[model samples]
Target: MILRFSQLIVGLILFGAGCAVMVDAGIGLDPWTVLAEGISKNTGIGIGWVVSITGFLVLLLWIPLRQKPGVGTVANILVVGAAMQFTLPLVSTPDHWIARVAMFIAGTALVGVASGIYIGARLGPGPRDGLMTGIHQRWGWPIWAGRLGVEATVLVTGWLLGGTVGLGTVLFAVLIGPMVHVSLPVFDGRARRRRHTTPAAAVGGLSAPGT
Candidate 1:
């Protein structure tokens, strides 16, 4: 339990830092971050603050979907944006195109890894993911359909509002799923326990020998 909790916190912190890294890359951003950037640009608010607020607003939608928030859900709202705010100022946009591309790739990979780590902990779904699942629960919508509808809407809206939209967005969309797929089982607590359980250990736990 302690380890899972630790993984959750660390993963979320890394997730926010990864998002900041991508922002510093300035190539593009994920759908949610793009929207946050758009809102930040218009409101003169910090992008991180916008992210947290957006998460909170999304969570509210879950009420109608009959979704429940957990420790990880609440932690996600508070920690991720705070970490992004702290990390962003430390990173600057690189001058060279190659450097910027490399930075974006690294950031995307980091976000994928962070997603696996926190999700494997099984504490709760992030607000955006929960919203999609909630939509599924309420209306029997396919999760993919829900994700597509929401992301496409945000991406277009963000693009209209002056967020960067480019090759990085394309790369993130193509690569994140596979990356998370590889990382998830590696970090999953159940998988971890299964790996640690040797044949002898399993046998020892059974009532075999005379007591």
Candidate 2:
């Protein structure tokens, strides 16, 4: 239990730091961050606050979906944005394109690794992640379809609201799925044990053992 809790905290911190790294890379951001950025720009709130507020707002949506929040879910809503707030001041964008690109790639990879660590802890899904999975279960949609629909909607809305979108956006879209796919087993010990276990069982469901 201690180990799982540690993993969850570390993962959330790393995830937020990764988002900060990508933002500092000055290229683009993940879809959810893009929305946060847009909201921050429009509302005069700090981006970190926007992130936390967005998380809580998303959690509200979970009620109708009958989704239950766990310790990690609540922690996710608080810690991730706080980590980002702490990280952004310490990091800066490189002037060179190559360095910027490297930061973007590293950031994306860290986010994937973080996802594996926290999800493997089996506490609960983050607010946005819960929404995606809930949509999948409720509507009988493929997970990919649900993710794509949610992400695309946010991406477009963020763009319309004046968020930055660039080659990094394309790169993130192309790389994140595969990155998380490959990284999951490395962090998820239970998943590494079974060759045939579905990702849903390995990472997504509410029935996490020993949780």
Query: For candidate 2, lDDT tens digit of each residue in 143-163?
Result: 889988989999999888877
RMSD of each: 4.6, 6.0
Q: Which candidate leads in TM-score?
A: 1
Best by lDDT: 1
- Model 1 ranges off by over 4 Å: 192-211
Candidate 1 vs. true structure, TM-score = 0.91
What is the overall TM-score of model 2 with all chains considered together? 0.89
Clash number for candidate 1 = 0
lDDT (10s digit) by residue, model 1, range 1-211: 8998999999999999999999999999889999999999999999999999999999999998999999999999999999999999999999998999999999999999999999999999999999999999899999999999999999999888888888889989998999998888788968667666766768887433321
Instruction: Report clash pairs, candidate 1.
Output: none
Candidate 2: where are CA atoms >4 Å away?
A: 196-211
* Count of backbone clashes, every candidate in sequence: 0, 0
